[model samples]
Target: MSQPPKTQHASIPEPLAHPETRGIELIQATQRHGRARDLFPVWAAPNVSVLNFTVGASLILLGLELWQAFVVIIIGSLPWILTGIVATSGPAAGTSGSVITRAIYGIRGNRVVVAFFGWFISAVFLALNWLASSFMGAELLGQFGFTDPVLAPVLVTIVVAAVTVLVAVFGHGLILRSYPAVASVLLAIFLLVTAFVLPHAQWGYVAPEPLEGAPLWSAMTIGFAILASTPLSYTNSPDLARYLPESTKPSRIIAATALGGALPCIFFTAAGALMATGIDAVAMDLGIESALLALLPAWLGPIFVVGVIINTIALNGMTTYTASMAFQSIGVPIRRIPSAVVVGAIGTALTIYLVMSTSLLDAVNLMLQLLVLISGPTMAVFATDVILRRNRYSGAELFDEDPGSPFWYNGGWHVPGLLAVVLGAASASLFLTNPAWTGPIAAAMGLVDLSVPVSLLVTAGIYIALTRLAAKRRPGVLPAVENAAA
Candidate 1:
């Protein structure tokens, strides 16, 4: 509530109902005050979406036993390590995640990454959730004897999109405030779902017919890829964490984020696997809605539908919020609200068409596979840059458009960072496998998809080595923090 510490960046414009004047500017220290632990609920709330339950169901279908599938899921969750670590940079950088990447990739180079991983990828997520929710909304209506199938989903999408856009327009403060209530309700719903299902699960410790040779390995690889690659879609977590006080320790933040993100994911994923044990996993092709409708008690079915609908709205709020931040990072002459509106509109239209014409799960899976290629390298580049050059950000230099600014390298692009991303993406492309396309190298290499892991290693190694060499040779190619105390 109090005014923040003085900074050269322009004063933030006060909002009538919600916080405003955020996007690409340094959040002053006074504004940077919140408990690190609160992030757990906020981060955890969005993971309750239908996609997560599908992920659990997916692993079982991949030929893993119930316990084996769950274990593999735990293994896939390692990407949250970077997710939590990157969030700690929010206070120090006093900016959104995409803007902070300028410290590694330079101002112009950051735009490239933002366009692909930030805007495009975010739009993909927003659309997928929108499609799922619309169908679920229609199904819920049908249960009440409103049998106009065509009319139901179309009307539901309009309402959902409008609400999500309004919330996103309010931006960070409102989004954070809404999470606790949402998360509590979501947690209770999943707990009920889990409690009801686990007792009835007939799955054995091992699959009835175990997968053999390359089929088994490839299936396991895809399962891990799905789990690990999940975090790639959320690389902009620092955009939310930027509101936290600079004094918040990274360790505390990381622990909160990890638990918040992992717990809901594990519970729902396991529920999906359990659902598969009773009914055919293939019947769950429609994702969480199908799984829930098929699995939940008849009396509780309406509640499950409502929970999923609410979950979709909450997820879209975060997606649109982060996408707005990514839009600002693009160096465009657009404000945050307008950017969010435009993206939300396009995603809504796309979702409506896909819901009417195609399979949402198939589309989502393809997008996620592509995300593995893009997000893996993007995270690797950003994380590696932070580790190699900690405390080396110049808050002013991040917004510096001048070629001579510390963040500006080789005509406003960091060549080494760009090179690393390109190489990492190309490497990932070789091993990518999805419904629409499979990588030639992945098929050749025993059909094993090592895209995320390979991309992470290759990008991190190249970035760290090149950055160190550049720093040594140029004697200050990367910027350092202006404040010694900082």
Candidate 2:
């Protein structure tokens, strides 16, 4: 492999004072800083939102008992381990996940994947989280008697979008420095929420007409898929971890990232499910925020609203940051700050449209469901590549777009990797069961959705087999197994 360029040391700036100037470029070893443990809050803060509560509530609405929902939540969280594994590539490669994927999918081929799965999906999530926060913000306003239905939502959305955009424009340094505090605040508020809601929970609550046989399994699988969507969407885990020093242990990174995300998601989502047991399912479905606010004392209502908005900013900021990076990685002409602004503007517009026209719960459910067909396979491919390559990545070579670059296989496309993603997504579609459409396999199997597992297995299997075969036939295509260690 060609040697990386000589290290160019850049002094770290005061994160609050200056915006981060780096885009999709590789971080030099000298410029790398931070510890794996720091990643905990970075991952945690985003998942600590009212949105996750809705996810739990949705599981209940899907006809599963409380225990079944808990089980599904835990199982869904397993993908965060894959997220952690993908994150290790960050420090080892010293570049954002979007950039590092150049090796797995080849330079040009990766651009398409990053543009669609990375950027587009991120933008949608940005909109979804923003919409969730705007609803809470408007409700908070209502608590103070500012309940102009139309005006309140517009004002709140604008402010929320602006704050989220500013954070994204500030970029990685600020995110690293601030997320710990954000996570702490959100956790504290939610803990209070839990304390209040726990007492009202119907622990042994059972569905009036409990589903049995194929129907029960179907509900469980669908619930698992819904909960899994959040973790699976985070292929950008490496985007935040790229600044960590190369010497950081992979195990630390894996544990920190996985636990940080899984713990809060499980807790908050379970809280949502618990809250639902006391709430009428119809009310919870119509407006989770309203239903939740009705349960809390008046004083806590505003506080909870504020917490939801803060959580939204944290979540949306992370999404915008990743989307900005994905845009740059797609060979966009604009720089990072402009890219962030563009993403924010798009998300804001989307939030307004959804608020004015669509049902929030329906949008959230459909978006999460549709995303799995792509996200599951995508994350699986990324994790599999990390293992097959043994975490060995050349940051500098990834930047080289020339045909001579080591990653420039078959005219800037690794046929096996691209083909694997296509076949995996296609296979996944066959087993997908969502409101919009039910897959053939799902229909045959009594409405059970197996897309999540099917996509992961097919994508990983194909990539591993094809990668090994290509490596055997072409010696330089992959690193020697003994020499390939991060």
Candidate 3:
């Protein structure tokens, strides 16, 4: 691997001490600080949400037995490992994942994916999380006898959006410093929730009329896809890891990122599954809040609401922070703070519409199921690029935009990389099964959704083969152009 260029340490403000004013710029070696372990809370605090509980419960509703649901949760959570591997690029490249894509898809070509996958998808997630938080916030208010339905939702939306956007606008420093405490508080509340909910679980619960053969397999695949979508959607892991020093070991980064996220995700999701066994599947169909609140004592209700809202802010804070970088990466001539405010404004609007016009439970299920088709291929291409270059990148060269720049191949587009993504997403669509639409192949195959694996394999295979062939024609292309900084 090529070494990052040596430069005198820049006198940047300590990220933990002040607002991170930087955008997508390269971080000098001296500017880099923080250990790999610090990333644990950064990733963990965000996953401690009721969304995981809903996903876990959906497995039982889909006809899986309790043991089967546990197996699915473990398998589905494996995508965090892929997410961790992608994070190694941040320290190696000394820049956010949004900028690193210039190396894979070229400057202009990258804008398309970055805009769609990075900005648009992230904005949608911001709205979804904000909506979740607003629901919980309103429920908390209702307990206080503030039950004016119209007035309650509006008030909750404002409070949730304000807290989330402010943290994001403050940027990286505050996030890192605050997440450990956030994670601890959320974890404690969830453990208390677990204590009250688990005893009511039917440990050996089975579906009243168990699905058989192809139907069973199809249900399992869909369930796995739903559970995996949360981790797979996070192609921005590198955004958080970008400030870590280059000397940070790859194994440490990968372990901390993967374990931190996967452990809580599995635990809470399984807790949801356990909770599902005790409730009427019909009652859960209403929403996680009603189902869960019915089981908890009145005193724990307010505490549970607090945990949900805190987790939402943590989740949306990370999304908005990364989405701002993505907006800049799209060639927008905007700074970080303004971009975050714009994202927040848009998310708040969407949250209000979702609250008034649609069922939150239905929207969540459909969005997650469809998201995997695009997110799986996008993440696969990024992980494949990181491996091909041996995690070597030039933070400065990635910023280069001239025609002579190494990344400006074939008129600012890496044809092979772009082709791989297009083909991979198209192929995955043929096997996708969701409420919006079922893919032809999936319909033919008794509704089995194989979109996740199909997308990853197809995207990775094409990129590797094409990248190697291109390297044969151009000697210095394979190992990342020797990192001009080196």
Candidate 4:
């Protein structure tokens, strides 16, 4: 990455003055003062929104009974346990997740991964949140007797996008400061939703009625696939954790993140499953906002709708911030603020297209399922790289654009890392199952999907074997940097 010409900003606040725009630069020690505990709110607040409810309802629609759905919801949440583990890499690397990829894949090679998987993942998430937020805000305004079918939704979409962009423009300090408040409010609103919906639930009304032929095996696979895709959904955790003190224990970070992400999702998804039973219509047909309105008491319904709007703000803000970082990693000349605006505009456009298109939900499901194909292999490659190197990386050299730097392998291509991603993604593609698309392997295996586990193992195993072989072929080909004992 080429260093930008430094420009001074005297008026900005200390915390928000994160003036360093270089994608690979280390976050200085002064900025590394956030606590490990803050990440709980950062992650938990977004899941506390209607997204979990929708996911819960989706599980039921996919053929799981209420009790079976609840069990799978809890089990599906297990993947989030890795959130804190991945967050720890931030402080150690002092860079955004995409920049850290240069350590695994060479700098140039990392761009292809970033463009198709990393940045595309962020944009897709932004679009999803943008649409949900806008939908909620439009509904809430309609409740206030401001219902205008054409103008209202458009206005709400604009407002939500504006708020997201402004928050993201300010960057790190605002994100850290806002999380606690967002989490508390969302938690309270969702609890009220649970209380009102549970008493109305028809516990024994397991649909003897036929909706679709989603088998038990297919339901479980889709459920697991949903959770597997979540890590990529909110890739900002590490970006936030990059500001945390290096001394924070990995265990504490992991615990806080796991609990914070898991509890709300489990609770709300269970509630949503119950809500699905009480309502006669399919959950998707009602949509989350309409379902909440139909199920919750009149007084709490508006409050829950408002909560969705707020939740989307928090989610999109972090998404924009993280995505801007990913964009810069693509060798863009833009700085943080400009990059944020550009990404926000793109997300907003996609959000509009999603709402206009009849295939929005199907497209979203397909993308989420495809996430396993992207993130699964990427995660495996990253884990293997860090473990083999024993966390030894020259942070400064990683930013160097010159030829001799360790990260600039074979004209900015790490052959083994590239090969690992290809092999892993190929295996993952073989197991994908979504409404829009199903993999050959998934079809052959009686519609069972095993993409996530299959991709991770293949990616890591191939990368390791290739690296070992390469090392033997040409002694001392890979550069060794002095390891940091920390």
Clashes of each: 0, 0, 0, 0
Question: Pairing residues by index, what is the TM-score of model 3?
Answer: 0.95
lDDT of 3 at 113: 85
Question: What digit string (tens of lDDT, one per residue) describes model 4 on residues 187-292?
Answer: 9988987888888788885766433454677778887787667763444456777766555677777777778888888888788778777766665574666666
| TM-score of each model, paired residue for residue | 0.92, 0.95, 0.95, 0.89
lDDT of 3: 0.85
Candidate 1: segments with Cα more than 4 A from true spot: 1-16, 148-150, 205-208, 285-288, 479-486
Instruction: For residues 244-358, write the lDDT of model 3, one tens digit per residue.
Output: 8887888999999999899999999999999999998678767777888888999998899889889999999999898888878878999998888898998888888888866
Q: How far is candidate 4 from the true structure (C-alpha RMSD, Å)?
A: 4.6
Error of 2 at 120 (Å): 1.9
List, residue by residue over 363-452, the lDDT tens digit for candidate 2. 788888888988888899999888877787878778889986888888899988898889999998898889898999999999999989
Q: In candidate 2, where is summed lDDT lowest over 10 consecutive residues? A: 2-11
Model 2 lDDT vs. the true structure? 0.85
How does residue 447 of candidate 4 score in lDDT? Answer: 79
Evaluation by TM-score, superior candidate among 3 and 4: 3
TM-score pick, better of 1 and 3: 3
The lDDT of each candidate is 0.76, 0.85, 0.85, 0.73
